[model samples]
Each structure stands twice: as structure tokens, then as C-alpha cells.
Target: FEALHAAVAGLPVSGSRVLPGLVLRRDFAAYCPASGELAAVVVTESLHPALSAPGVEFVVGSEGQYQASLRWCTRRTEAVMKRLQSSNVKLLLSSVKQQEVVIYYAKLYGVSVVECLSSEEIALICEITGVSPCTPFGDNGEITETAVATFCQPLLLGSKRYVHVGFTSVCAFQPHCLILCGPVDGVNEQHAAALQGAFTMLQQLFKTVDQ
Candidate 1:
């Protein structure tokens, strides 16, 4: 599915294999669609874009240390969210659900949160944005300084909702999306394999011709 999706996008953008578009396949999970600017793609270790601070460990009689850890995290998380907000980052995309404390601060800072993104989707976003996947910030191995998305929204297709966006920094051509849907998993898998193979062939052919 990814190979085909990228190939299709390559066609419109002068034919380089780096995908000029992004695709979101439905996983049959019930999720609401949303719209926001994907201005930055940050690779995070934790839900928040901040690093864990050095704090005292909690012992049987020392719950204060645990409380301090929570407080430290919340303060750092809020600071990070504020930076994102000031930078006009309206969307927060995470691979998993974050702690409510993270959510509350993001909301307070006026950033929309979208969780449950798969690794592929996140990688695709990074590629489209030309963001380095291994970008590091401070002592933490997280990236917080990449931006590219121009427009973003969620679209309802079939029985699922998919996020859609138009890129501002895409390849020379316009972005594209190829959504493949099937009633059953087997059917979709077969179709995805076939489609991917076909596009792979075309990609090889294009590369040969370009060379």
C-alpha cells in the first residue's frame, strides 16, 4: 500500500520516489476526523515533547518524590505546549493516547490533540515535511523543529474517518492520495499487494528512463 501510494504521488511531482503525498488507511477503528496544520513533525519518546527531569525516587514512605515527578512533568509539558502554540501549531499528533495531564495543558494552550497514529503514518509525514527522522533536541532524542503542512482536515470515507492534508512543501507537483478499501482484510491485503507490485514496476521503469 505504501509503495503504491508513494508511486502515485511521485508521478505528479517529477517522478522521484520520495512520496509527494500521504495516505491514511482505515483500520476499522472508530475515530473522529479533525483538521489542523501539521506544521511540525516531532519525534517524541514520551507523550510530551520534553525530557524527563532528574527527581528523587519514590520510596514506601516517600510519596513526595512521586508527586514532584508529576509536577515537574506537567510544568515541562506546559512549557513545551506553549512553544508549540506560539509557533502556530494547532495539531498534536501522537502514536498513542497521552496522559490526561498532557491533554489538559495542550487544550489550555489551544493545541488540538490527535492520537493513535501508526509508525508508517508518522514516517510518511516526516518524509513529506522533509524533516529529519533522527533530529535531536537537547539531551533528549526528540525532534521539535520541523514544519511543512499547509492544510489539513479529516474526511469520512466508507465506515471510517481518515485525515487529509494538502502539502505546501511537496515535490514540484501537487500532492495525491490513493485510498484502497475492501470489505474484508484478505481482500484488501491481496489488492494492496497487487497495487504495490504494479506501482513498484512502474517506479523501476521510471527510474530506468530517468537514468
Candidate 2:
């Protein structure tokens, strides 16, 4: 709570409550989604531009966080179900939902949801791996891997072509995993090596328990 409060103070923006968009880092139990599943959800307009893709569909919602799209993602479990229901909808990468919310709704809807690393956690991963989050405030790490992968991977993979405004959250499984999002091609070898080293060190740290 103190960390979040401090991060918020650093931001020029002000709000009574911490918005999901403002979240840079968080920690919680991991949730598991069923294998080979596709999900969708309502995202904030702030996020829609960066997130908009071919397979994923979007509809305007009151708030960027919880809206109709999330509902659709939850209710429409199978691609087959979505197809049978609507010809226009297409599934891209699965939607990233909060772990706690996913667990509660998964049981209620009988649809499985996956646990994702928090935005700050992803930032730490990049730092540990030697890759910079590359934002003015270094707060980009506050986003989710799902968001990061969607926006950043294209830049890394050479599809998106231009940098978009606002932070796109992304995550990775490796301890020192570094995901760079930008029109810039190929992670420079130096950064890549650092990421490799960081990941190695992190792995060793975790291995302590196993030992």
C-alpha cells in the first residue's frame, strides 16, 4: 500500500482511488486457466488503442477497467461458442484478468482464467534481466505482461511499426525475462546479454528453495 501510494504521488495525475491503469506493480496468488483457452474482456479506452488487434474485438465501455468486453470474454468461453453466436467476433490473444477476480468469476461462470504477473513484477523482471522499461518515469513496468506482449511484442517482432502513447503492460515467465516494446528492432545484444545474466541470477536465487 505504501509503495502504491508513493508511486501515485510521483505521478502528476490525481484521483481519489487508484485506477487499474495507474497500477504499476502488485502481487497476489496465481490463478490457472484451463489449457488451450481463449478469453476476452472489456478494457479501458486508455488501453484500447494499443491493444486493438485483428483477432481481438472491442466495444466502448463506461470505464476502461470493467466493462462489457470483460463480460463477453467471461461468458464466451470457446471460440466455437463465439463463432456460433457472432460472425464478427475474432479471438486474438486471451484477455488478461486480475487473479482474484478471475478466480471468483471463473467459479461463477465455470470458465477458467489464467494468473498473470503484476505490472511492477514485470518491471522488476526487466530490471533483473538488465532491460530498461524505457519510460520517462520508469513506471511502465506497472502494466501487465498480457498488455506488454500485445503492444511491445509487435514492436520487437516488427509489426506495429510506431510507438503508441500510454503504457502497455506485458509479462514473461522467466525470472530475468526482458520484453522490449518499441518500433526498434532486435533487442541489442548488450541488453539481451544482460537480460540473460539477470535471468540466470534470478534462477539461482529461486533454486535456493529447491536445494
Clashing pairs in 1: none
Work out the TM-score per prediction: 0.69, 0.23
Residue 180 alpha-carbon offset, candidate 1, angstroms: 1.7
Encode model 1's per-residue lDDT on 37-130: one tens digit a residue.
4564444444554333458543534678767766776777777667666666666656666677777876676666556667877765665666
Evaluate model 1: give its TM-score.
0.69
The TM-score that candidate 2 achieves is 0.23
Error of 1 at 110 (Å): 2.0
Backbone collision count in every prediction?
0, 16
Q: Quote the positional error of residue 44 for candidate 1 in Å.
A: 2.5
lDDT of every model, 2 decimals: 0.56, 0.31
